[model samples]
Structure formats: structure tokens, C-alpha cells
Target chain A: MELYHRIQIQDVVRLDHAALDAVEAGFRALGQGRVVQPPILSMAIEESNGEVDVKTAHIRGHDRFAIKVSPGFFDNPSLGLPSLNGLMIVFSAKTGLVEAVLFDEGYLTDIRTALAGAIAAKHLSRHDSRRATVIGAGVQAELQIAALKLVRDIDTVDVWARDTDRANAYAERIRERFEGLTVNVHGDMASACREADVIITTTPSKSPLLDAGHLPAGVHVTAMGSDSPEKRELEVSVMTCADVFVADTRAQSESNGELKAWAGKTMPFEVQELGPVIASGQSPRTGHDQITVCDLTGTGVQDTAIASFALKRLVA
Target chain B: MELYHRIQIQDVVRLDHAALDAVEAGFRALGQGRVVQPPILSMAIEESNGEVDVKTAHIRGHDRFAIKVSPGFFDNPSLGLPSLNGLMIVFSAKTGLVEAVLFDEGYLTDIRTALAGAIAAKHLSRHDSRRATVIGAGVQAELQIAALKLVRDIDTVDVWARDTDRANAYAERIRERFEGLTVNVHGDMASACREADVIITTTPSKSPLLDAGHLPAGVHVTAMGSDSPEKRELEVSVMTCADVFVADTRAQSESNGELKAWAGKTMPFEVQELGPVIASGQSPRTGHDQITVCDLTGTGVQDTAIASFALKRLVA
Candidate 1:
């Protein structure tokens, strides 16, 4: 007889700094070549306007690993339901017995993705970075800024969205949460990114929204959206102008992220991975005058890491 | 908020003929090209002697689909644990929200795999088939024979295993459950298969155990054991000698089943899929003197079908 536990979304929403640290360690492990992360298995259900992706990774020597089933039904919002929902199945690596199912309903994905943005900024941004600009005013737009505050002393935020009302509402939400922090709604992408020390793109845009001319010198950018082949956020020139161009994984970047703009051509600059950057103590930014860009298409290591972390918290 | 239900292994063991019919319908749907099943996602944990495979499929017009996590840790039996363990996570096709989690401990897999063997025999074997021979006296060996009775009036059974005592024990168990059926334990594979009208192979052997010479004319063979690249139960000549060759899926058979013996080469006969054959009502064996071989590598449609069926039963 085996025992199986169910950890729900409410239980997962209480994730703290420890959960972020666990995800960071997963990246470090991957960078050190101690993780076996396979290519994602994706299937589209055209009839229901939905798609499902299965991701899993094993961190060497870990007691447990996780296989996450992430499904996105784009039409769910019309049915009075959330668009994204799924869970993580965690198993004991030693015996292959299922330990728990984290029915987080995509909450863990949101947490880990936000944490990845923070991890990128911790290594790439300058210590004095304060001002931030966020493209898109969705759940990720708000979460990315909140996550960034973990590493940088973010005091002011500029938000740009195609919908002005949503952008203003996003600003108001941020203002209520962070006391003394100034939030501004920008009408254009260029104006929003002009004076920012860090810029985060969190849109599901099908075309490039930010180009090389939009970036201020020394500003670090984290493109958190564009996780599918048909979506891209940064222009190709934006990548060419950056001093450091990092990806969560090179293969994913080529097929699903901003690097898809490269069109199978070799990049002019050396490409770095977030895992290696975190594992090694080397900062790609040597001076305050160099631009940096991080492309996050997401990875399986983050899912397993966050799931393992959530299960420990729930059980404890 | 979304609700998730956990249906345990004990709850799943109550599968009956209706559940088997549900799985059979799944195969029919796949055969008719109404299912969208993606390639399997497999990851190996070599250090722990375990491997995990994720399988899912969306059957057209169905309200829900299933993503099954199957992990096999060969060393678990020594630890007083079953070597196979995992569950199926079912989601609503319209919203992609998790409908339920069936922590069935691989009971559903067993039920479906056993039904698949019976399905093949029903479509390919002679209607008057009354004698059955099973190679390897394992759980599947017993289940396959029991499931076969749903299709044929099996009155006698011959079983062969590496260990004769285990074979005798299997015979006794069958005798107790299936009253009026004569069961025999055979020491040699050839003798066990000689006088049988239906032959089912259920072993984890890494080499060929049955050849063309062992298969008598007019006998229908259901090779259910070889589901990995390293395992092969039927010799290539056995396939060549068959009047018709059917696979659960051509792609899986080429990689993991006895069809791997063909080594990327085309077979002399047209290879049919079991689903289409069932859907079309086409019997590959017209006369009682022709041999038919059905290779069972398992499929995602079966998992989704059985999971959906089990959920309906549990909820009701």
C-alpha cells in the first residue's frame, strides 16, 4: 500500500524566499551539468483551442523529481475559468513511487518564472539599479516587478500595455502594494524603457515590440514571454546591440524565444546560459555602460525544483 | 477555484467488462484517426534503476483527456515494493483544468494492456478458438487469459515460465477462478505453443523466445511483452510467416516491439493498425488456415480511455 498526497493551489500560493532559492539552485545544478532535462513534449488540441506541454528533469542525487503537466486553454476565460491550469506529479527518484501531486493550478509556474527573472537580474544588473520598466500589464507583468524587488532596490516602475486601461489598473495595483513606490503608465514602449535600469517584457505578442533603439545604455532586459515558436518580444537588433545575450536554454531560445529572430544564423556575440552564469561567479556586465538581455523560454529544471520545494513545505 | 479528486488503487481494481469496452472504443477511435496522441516523453534515471514515460492523447469530441505518468524501477521488488508504480492525471478538454487524479498504482494500465490482447484475439483469431497458450506466468499472463475469455470460449490453457513452480502456481490460481477450464504447466515453450489456437507472450526477455517454427498454422499470436528497444520476444521469421501483421502503432512497433527485428526495413506484407482493423470490421484472417500476428506496444489512447472510464465509474 502506497500513500499519495494532494497539494492544492492555496497551499502553493504561500511560497516564500526558500522556494525561490530552491529554483535558483536548480538552475545552478543544470549549469554544473548535474541535471538531465529532456526536450518538452507538447501537443495541441485544436478542437478545444488548447495545448498541453509535459516537462520533467532529474537533478543528480535529488531524492525526488517532478513531471509537470501544463495545459493552456485559451478559450477558458470565456467560460468563466482560468486559461492556464494543471499540476505537477512528484515521484521518489529512489523507488519510482509517486509521493505527491501538486495541483497548484499554474501557481508554481508563475512563482518559478517570476523567480527566474529575479535570478537573471541578480547576476546581470548593477547594485544601484532602482527604476524598472515592464511591458505588458498581465499577471506576469505585476509578478515580475515584485520578484525583481528581491534582488534590486526597485523604487519606481513604468508599465506599458497595448490597452491603456489595463496598464493604469496595473499601476494602481502596484501602488497599493508597495508603499512609497512611484508607478507610471506609459503610452509608448520607447518612453517607458528610456530611463529604466531594468526592463521586463511579459507579453504574448506575435511580433517584436521592443527594438535596439528603445533600450537605454547599461539597462538589463528580461524577456519572460514568447515561450512558443509563434511569439517573439525583442527585435533581432536588440540582441545584436546587447553586451551579454543570455538564454534559459540555447535550444529553446532558437525555437521558441527571441533568438528565433536570428533565423538559424549564428549570433555575432557569445551566448550565455542563465544556469552557467548563476553557477559561476562571473558577471557578464563589467561596467555600468553595457547593455544586457536575458531570454527566458522556461525550462523543466525550474518546474521540478519548485515542485520539490512546494511538497516539502506542504508536508512540513 | 478548481476541485481535484484522488481515486486510489483499491478503487480502480473494480474494473469490469464495461471498462474493457471503453478501452476497446479508444482503440477504435485511434484506428479511425479521431485521436491526437503525441510522441511519448521518456526520461531515464540510470542511477536509481528507473525510467519514466509520459503518455497522453486527446480523443476527438471527448470531454476529458488523460496524461499518464508511468515509472518503472526494476530494483523495487527487492525493497518489498512493486517495480511499477504511478498514476493518470485527467483534464477537461474544454478548459484544460484538471478533472481528477487517478492514483491507481498502474492498475488501469494492467487492465487496458490485458484488454488490448483480448481485443487483438477477437479481431484476428478464429471464432471457434477454445485453446490458449501463454508464455511467461506473470501478472499479465494471468490477466491476458482472463480478459481473453470475454472474446473467446477458452476451455483449456497452457502456461510456460522460466520457473516451473511459478508456472504451477499460476495454473492453480487460474483453475480456482476460472471453473470448468483445464490448465496445464508446460516445461518447454514449443510444447506449450504447439496445440494452441491463440498464443500470448508476456515476458521481459531481452532475446527472442518464440520463432516461426514454434507457431502452428492458423494460430493467432499476441506479443504483449516487448515494449522497450532492448526486449524482443518474436523472431523476424515469425512475422514473415504470418498471413497478416498488425501493430498497435506502427511507430512504436518499429522502435520498441518485435517489429524492431525488421531494422527499419519494409515488411513483405502490409502492416495494419489494430484500431483501423477494429473500426473497419476487417478480419485479416479469412480462412482458418492462415496465421495472424498482433504486436502490442501499448498506446496513449488506451490510457486516456481507461482513465476516463475509471473516473466515470469512481465518480458515479
Candidate 2:
């Protein structure tokens, strides 16, 4: 009899960069029509002020499993706990049996999202880009940097946060983690936004954070946050300035952020899907100074891709 | 961090009779709106002649969680293995934390289903009933026997199967495990159907196994096998003769067995839900000779109820 293995979140904590790399490959595999991802079902708990989602997918020639319990951890600070919890189960399609369970829900989410950034940047970011600015010095902030490094030869990283101490700490961590990479702790948000070849925002704020006027020409901004309707990370003016705007899903992005603000209005740009860009090589690295922005709303395909990839790595 | 423990299937076997009690309590809890079970989703693999389903449920007042897996064990007989496989997970609604992982997918499915029979019999079975004829002695056949014992005082059980050896083996096992019960093996299906005050069928066949004309008066038949559209345990004539026909869900029954046959035509009878019957004291138990049939197309509510109850039992 084949036994189903249950893995706890406490069992695997440090599945960081290596896991993200595997997840990136999964996305590519998904684009190749090698995976089947069902629509993600999200349950937003208003009373608890949090949300949880269950994502299912069938990775053809890879894995058939669903990622359950990707619940947003809220009350972590007050409860003295991490801000995310849950498990992912890999079930076999051959026998319709749950083969393994992984407990690192938050870490998995982090890596998958970061891998998405890496994928977007690999196709979208300029080849000569060396500096990147990251807003929101939180858990996701560090991951964005890690993912960016895998795509571009990034040397200098500008970090900004509401809490200067946290930003400084994040900068220190980046310096220690990435040897010979200069970590610049910016005092002002606008200063962090300007003169960077690439920029990523990973904040949970409802209003815009960066000043649009501060952005240099030809900058590639990846809005890594702003997942729901209430979230808007990029300034409304940034939407107008962006030469080409790309999104993980046009529907999801249109309801959230600057896209929501610009929706139904006459905008000079066209919304391109991430999958098509990856599929047709449409997301090309243009000239040295072409402005680009990718608004990622996080699709079910990413979950399917990551799950399919992880299962293969585990079994192999 | 709260950790969900895993109970491997090998650690526990013969979870048949054990689940009937829990299933009964779960039904009561379900009527109380303390459980939330979505409808069961399935996909039939036509080429392989197999089916896969993802069964999920959320039980209220016990920390919300859904049990998910593609459980397919119908192919086990051909593979020389148990045909059922899947995983049961209990997750927290408040924190989105997975609390427990039970690896006995098909075992739990069988147990909960049999328990539903026991629950149905507890309210619908004949009083002073001392005999039961199980139509098909497959996996759930023995469980139905155990479940009946909890609700009715049965002194003898007549077992019938397509294969005589399988029927004899089932009868001997029941006799060994359950005290105060005599096992009688039937030469044919009608012999068992002729004497039974309560009839139970647990086959995966598409055609009717027993004759409606052979059924004795006042017998309560619990049809456990016909859940899918292509499967059934009773003939259309038998349903027409039933005085009271109760089902888990009227909508689901219409798509499955007896109802599927009676589609576009008036229902054999106006169906009553199990919830209202259990909540109200109006369940008719006038005598030991009322021909009542409760066709159970297993609901997601049952899964939620049992999963919640099991979690409580584990914690306590």
C-alpha cells in the first residue's frame, strides 16, 4: 500500500532561494501547456480581517495536486505568530491518492510569487540594468531582491519603508546575503523610486506609495503587491507614464490599483497577458531606455505551475 | 504554530463499524447547521473505467476545514489492491491552519457512508426488527451490517453477493466481529431479499440486483451504492412501491439512480430531506411493517460533519 506523507510547516523552514528556482521552472512548464490549474477559490473573512485561498491544479506529466490553506496571516503581531499558515498536498492522478503534504505554506507562497517576479524580469527587464529599487521592507521585500538577482546582474539595491529601522535591517540582511552587492537604504520614498533601472513594490497599502514624477525614463516597475480591489501600490500618474503595461491577469489587475483607476477610461497603453508574453516571446527586452511595468495579480496558473514543479523535485 | 498530526492507514484497519456511531452524531450536528459540506465533484475516466472525486466540507463551531483528495479505489479490484485512496485534512477557518491529516481516504469514505445508513435506520428502520438482508456483500456491505446493529436489534443477517465465496466470507467476518448475530448465506439475491425487514445494497453495478416484487412488506431499504448517474441499486418499480422515499438531497438524487430514471416524469413521491426529519419528531415509525426507503447519495455535509467530529475526538 502506498502511504500518504504529511509534512508540517515546522518541518521545513529554509526552502528559500532553491525552492524559488524550482517554482520558476514550473511557470515555464505551465506556459508550455504542461499543466492544468483550476480557478483559485478565495474565502475572504471580513470579521477576522483576513483571507484564505485554495488552489487546485493538474500538472500534466508533472503532478496532480492542489495547494490548500494558503490563508493570509493577519493577527500575527498580536498573536505572536507568523502572518501565514497552511499546507499543500500532492495527490496522485494514477490512483487518485494524496501522496505527500508540505507544511511551508507562507514560504511556498513567497517563493512562488518571487519566482513570478523573476520570470517577469527575465523577459521584461533591460539587459544593462544594474540597480533596482524595492518599496516595502517586509518579508516579500527580500524575496523580490532574491528573485531579481537570478534574472539580472543587479549590483545596487535601493530599499525604502515607513519604518527606517526596518528598512535598514532589510538592507543589512541583503548585504549579508548577497556578497559584493551594495544595499542602499533610502531615507525618502521618492528618492528610492528615482534613478533605478528596475523597481518592485510589495506593500499591502490601499493608496499609492511612490511619487510618479520621480521615476526615471526607461524604468521597469513590477508592482508585486496590490492583489485585491482595496490594494493600489503604484501612483495613478505612473499608469499614464508607463509605455507598456503588462499584467498577470487583465481582469484581476483592472479591479485593483492604478489599473482600477484607469479602467474604462481612454488609456494610451494596452494590457498584455503574462502567459502570452512568455509563450510568444512578446515580452521582449526593448531598447536601453524603454519604460515597462508588469502588474502581477497572481493567477491560478502560478499555483499550478509551482505545485507541479515541487512534487517532481520531491519525488526525484 | 499549530501542527496537524498524520495517521497512516496502515496504523488503523477495519475502520468500518467504528465510524457508524460518529456518522450518526455528525448527521445530528449537520441538521444543527454546524457543518458545511460542498457537493462532491467527480470525473469519470472513460477509457480506464475509473472515477476520481475531490470531496470537501467545512464543519462550523469546530474550526473550519475541507477534506480534499482525488479518491479512486474502484480500480483496486483489477489492480489487486484496495480500490479507495485519498486524504482527509482539517484546517482552521480563523487562522487557515491545517490541524490534522488523516490518510485513510477510502476507509473514511466507507465508514462515513455506512454510518449514514446507521443514521437512516435509527430513524426509519422497523422496531422489533431481527433480520437484515444485505443485497451486495462488497466493501460497504459489512459496514452496513455494523451500522444497522447500532440502530436496530438484529438477531440474524442474510448476506448475498454475485460471488458465493465472497458472500460466505463476509458473513463469517460479520459473525466473528459482531456478537449476538447469526450469519445466513443466501444461495441467490432473492432469498436474502425475501426475508429481510431492512435491505442494504453496496455494489458499483449499473443494473438493479434485487427484484422489487420480491421485497417483503414493511422492509426499509438503505441504498448505499447508487451515487453516480450511471449507478443504481433499485428498480423503478421498487421506488414506485415505497411509501416514504427520503434522500440526502433531492437535487442530487434527480441526477443519479431512481430519480434519473424518473426524470421528466413526476417523482415517485415527494422527497423529504433527512435534516428536517431528524430535527422534527415526525419520522414515521408506526410499525415493523412499513416499506420505507432512504436513498443516500452521499452529501458533502456528511463529510464535513464526520471530519469535524473526528477532529474533536482526536483533540479530546
Best by TM-score: 1
Question: After best superposition, candidate 1 residue B279: deviation in angstroms?
Answer: 1.9
**lDDT tens string, model 1, B242-284?**
9999999999999988888878988777899999999998787
Candidate 2 residue-wise lDDT, A1-316, digit = tens: 2222334332342335565555555555566666555444555554455566665655555436444557775775677766676666655555555666665555566767887887788778887789999998898899888888877899999988888999999999989989999988989977887779999988888888865686888788899888877888887778677777788767667865458867667666777766667777566546677788888877655665555555555556
Interface RMSD of each: 0.8, 3.7
* Per-residue accuracy of model 1 over A1-316 as CA lDDT, tens digit each: 2222344545544435776789999999999999999899998888988999999999989999999999989888889988887888889999998888787788888989999999999999887999999999999998898889988999999999999999999999999989999998998998999999999999999999999999999999999999988899999889999999999999999998988887899889889999999999788899998999999998999999988888776777
True contacts kept of 1: 0.74
Model 1's DockQ score: 0.76
Error of 1 at B195 (Å): 0.8
DockQ of 2: 0.25
